[model samples]
Target chain A: MTATTSEPGLRPVQKSRYKRRSKGRGNFEMWSWVFMRGSGVLLLFLVFGHLFVNLMLGQGIHAIDFAFVAGKWSNPFWQVWDMLMLWLAELHGFNGVRTIINDYTEKDSTRWVLKTLLVVSALVVLVLGTLVIFTFDPCVDPGSTLSQCK
Target chain B: MTATVEENTEAKPGAVPTFEVTLRIERYNPEVDDAPHFEDYRVTVHGTDRVLDALHQIKWDQDGSLSFRRSCAHGVCGSDAMRINGKNRLACKTLVKDVNPGKPITVEPIKGLPVEKDLIVDMEPFFQAYRDVMPFLVTTGNEPTRERLQSQEDRERFDDTTKCILCAACTTSCPVFWNDGQYFGPQAIVGAHRFIFDSRDDGAAQRLEILNDKEGVWRCRTTFNCTDACPRGIQVTKAIQEVKRALLTNKF
Candidate 1:
């Protein structure tokens, strides 16, 4: 068990030496540092605004009924906003996860299985989430011609 | 003591100045090859140079067309990840001393993805998996006037998970991915785990549903390659286990 140069708490150096094949010299580490701060900064806005608009402002949390969501989706602004949030947060989170996966598993088989599952799940979620956001129909009141979803 | 050549062993006869190491690397060419093959490179090398430096030497002196990915020449870019001596590693971060130990170090592209060249594997599938996790926090509560009102403990839950860098080292080194390319893999789970453990996120329920599918978190066997190969030391298997625990107990 050797001491590590990474953050002292996690024993980063030991992990870096497990295979200890070649000189990586902290390239991925540097990019990861940049990514965390960049994504963290972006997530601050995306997460905060998402909360404020969905819960605090205007009608507040209780106003978030099905019809309220439909009404919000009626505007392109909210659509784009939610879209951006979904893409950014999901991508950021996924990359963050990739980092985690690389860190923990020690077996080749185990790592592959988990990562394969991750990619498939991410694809499914992105496809389904995008579809739901774009194709949402708000009104169930088909009998009345009040507002046509079309 | 007299400093004479007769008494010095530094000039000992038959002392080899260099050693030749055998590198059994996987080779692939989209134009000429249907599958990859192991090509051996016997290099007369200095002990101090890293494997990446050796690769650089190969590309520079032996074969300019010996393709591989490298940027930042350091471990941060995650672009130069490869399989070395049966383990995943960032080429730039790996040193020859550690891998060879007076032997040759084998290098190959990461598995679980399509190979682009000698040591470069496709990352689109890896990134595609990352995009699926709905990785951001979704809250329907009042935001604090400042900093979103997360307790230190709550923030700490996701803190360790926040260090990931989509390098594909863990995913490619995995054996399961070598067999089945469709698996969600560790990186995605790590990403989901970041949000799953986040106290402020309301999407845990939804994310759990996504992870509980047939090809979900249950697939992990806990080999710890992700942990071993992770340049960042994230405890990826533990996070996956946590996610599995969350799935079993209705708690994120």
Candidate 2:
């Protein structure tokens, strides 16, 4: 039988075969990790408050209608609250799904395609949601019976 | 007296009973076999026998071709670590009875690293990760004439992580490490934790910077597999969390 041994001074596994996209570029991952924790805590409050106000305070889920939403948006406090919730929840969820994709996807092409679709969808939702909040017209409906429409 | 002596030679009343255990070992001979497969060997062993003993029986009596790495069969050498009953464990440390000897015990090489032969893997990658973390004390300034002094509390700070044997059990059990070979794995993080929390080490910043890379501690999903697989019970997941917290707070 022939005796054999591994070569001397083999390269570190991380450096040898696997391709790393980020070149140790400043603490982006650190910040991403920090963002996950921070955004998670913030989302708890924002999400719970949104649910409490929308579903529990005064009128419950049945009270939620088009006019009810318009009335809430007409107020600056509620608009800012909804906008914060929208952005934070969307971005927080986006970053989360992005992390999942990064963890699971093996091929670079698969990661790129998934992340691209994620970014595009997130951008569309954020832009559309923000515009809807800012430029909301309660009087747009001709059959509206709200006091603001008069 | 003659009858008692013969009976004593036959079977002692309190002596441990022996049973036959079938070990289903994953075998791969790169020279011959294209893919890995399981081969069973039945061995009669005492209740006190370890998995290593069963392996030795198979190697010596049944199949001379069975190959495995082992040293200090009592488990200190960190060799002979493999998947026993689907869990990462040192064969020398795992008692056959503890692994449910009633059924077949599965012995396979730890995952993630390339399998070199039956129950042996290319540990270079695992060691490479360990080395990248700088698993040694880094001190600045001239060597002191006297040994550096540390308080009891300071010593206890990183006491848990100092028990790492580098068996690759914790790293192999990690799903993240299994999927992404580039991620620095839990063993590397535990190695960094060993020195990062050391009161005397001046290399915390450099090591922390190394771990702060994209493939660093950020990839840890807090699955606790490393913690569970740790033979030394080093609280692997907690150490990783502490390192992550240190990265955020810049304090150890």
Candidate 3:
């Protein structure tokens, strides 16, 4: 009896069918990973500061009325700080959730849908948050009794 | 052929204490079965027998149709990696008693690979990933007059990743690999790490570039499943992290 030959396996030079696409998005994933770490550290300080000032300093949580926000945003430093916090927090959260979506969603179409929804929601929050931080009016209420409103 | 433990004990009075171990193995015959199913077999095994031994007993005495792979009957060959009692382990390395022989031990093929038979998976994909990383050292320039030398400290940088035996245990245990087979799993990253951090290898840039793909090192979520599943105790996740760090710093 004669022995039959089997097909040869992949050679060292041959790429696997499962290999990631060669035309990669360059350093996008690496930069995203770095962004997560960098933004995470910055978020720690920004979030803690925001919390300490709003919930601990002055009259504490009771002092966080609309007038307080109006007074804070009226200053350029507070405006810049709040804007940075809003942008960093939104992008950080969006990137983190995007990663989760990519990890869990196996189908490309499904990932596309979820990611589209994620981007849309993130955009809405970011735009609204930025708008609220910058365009907030202290005297929007006509009958306001606060000195700043007067 | 299916003898009770008491019968076996009675047959050999002074023999080592033997117990009946029921191995519930997930079996699939592509030629016959439409889907994979579990099949149980009772084998009388000695106190010191490994899971591989019980499998052999079933194949030799009770069911000749049972198929599995085993080489060296020790941990070095890395050919017998399977899911033993819900965890990825080498059957030859896992003792029957160590895995609670009182309950039926469940043995199944490793995940994320095409199961070619009962306990054998088509390891081509795993090997492909390994080969994709260029596991061997690559050198450029003229050959050294003597073998390239390195300090002990430099050698130890990647020593932890050198223990990998390409078992596929670590890769198969990964949830990311399970969800996306395209992702170059932990084993490939370890394979790359073995050479990437090597002071002598000039292939770090190429291998790191390959791993920078979307489905490459970035796909790893630091789940640590690979580290826990490694039969050789290699720090699989740490190697992956080092690779990621190397990519970030452009310094291996």
Candidate 4:
């Protein structure tokens, strides 16, 4: 009997033969790797700063009431901070997931559907989040013209 | 090795040995034209010679311009996924002889992703969906001074999700993803599945919140294509179902 080995089918990669696509914008993978490191570094600061402000400052975690949120939104500084956080977190998190999808799902139709849902959802959140942060009103004098919160 | 198997058809049992089948393949060239065209080759094939092997032979002997990506040809690397006839398959594991005995096969690149050159599809958008799932394990507890111990049951629960090979078979198979590129797709579910069952994670409730929005897990139509296409034999629909069940029960 001839001695044989487990078929290379089990070794999907040793044959590697990974030649990057010849045509694309430029350095897609390189920029992606860079983006991960950059985003990771930025996320560290954003996440920590957010935690410190919300959980450790002033009355600390107890200051998270709706009024606390309205108070912060009144200040442009907090608004921008929240905006940046929202955008970065959403983009960073979403982009990371897009990578995983391409790697796993094989069917073109499935991939298409999944990605469509992702974009629609992300867009909806981004738009609504941005609007809420920018157009908030805190004064509630009852019959005042400040809309519902008034 | 597979070619040799075809060579031995005459040595078998009283059953008449079957002849080989040809596989017609689509070819593309960026420098020459705006479209891709078909090319055919007749090769005597056996049950062992997968379509991938046949393509390899054509490249090695007939055309050097033919290009494709394959690593760990056994299907672990998640590369070499393409269309065989109408279904998606890993070129390595799919045995050509089993697919058809009397007719030639057809091979094409996966849809949804931008075709970069020939069989290779651009993966930037797909990768983007992975990031959105928050695939990493996040903990709010104090940093462990020692290895965190987990009950064997907890570990066992998440074992299946951790096995994802990221082959793109499941995601590309969904109809929802075909029209919209932003859907998180199947791998994200697999990634969420990995941590969702872990007792070490406090992020399950929060993760579900992230997945609950309009574009979240609700987009799945329960199509079993993703489950069917998984090279690792993962139950994609099962994982999705578990997540859906959690959302309904936990009310988080």
Looking at candidate 2 chain B, the ten consecutive residues that score lowest on lDDT are B1-10
Top candidate by DockQ: 2
Between candidates 2 and 3, which one is better according to DockQ? 2
Q: Calculate the i-RMS of every candidate, to one decimal place.
A: 18.7, 11.1, 13.2, 17.0
Every prediction's TM-score for the first chain?
0.73, 0.84, 0.83, 0.75
Q: Model 3, DockQ value?
A: 0.25
Error of 1 at B36 (Å): 1.6
**Each model's DockQ?**
0.01, 0.27, 0.25, 0.01
Candidate of highest TM-score: 2
TM-score for each model:
0.56, 0.91, 0.90, 0.59
Instruction: Score each candidate by Cα lDDT.
Output: 0.69, 0.84, 0.84, 0.70
Residue range A10-108, candidate 2, lDDT tens digits: 211233444444567588888877777888888899889989988999869989988899899999998899899889889889988998998878677
Candidate 1 docking DockQ: 0.01
Q: For all the candidates, what are their Cα RMSDs to the real structure?
A: 21.5, 6.6, 6.9, 17.3
Per-residue error at B31 for model 2, in Å? 1.1
Model 2 chain A worst lDDT run, 10 consecutive residues:
A1-10
lDDT of 3 at A72: 95
| Candidate 4 residue spans exceeding 4 A from truth | A1-150, B1-19
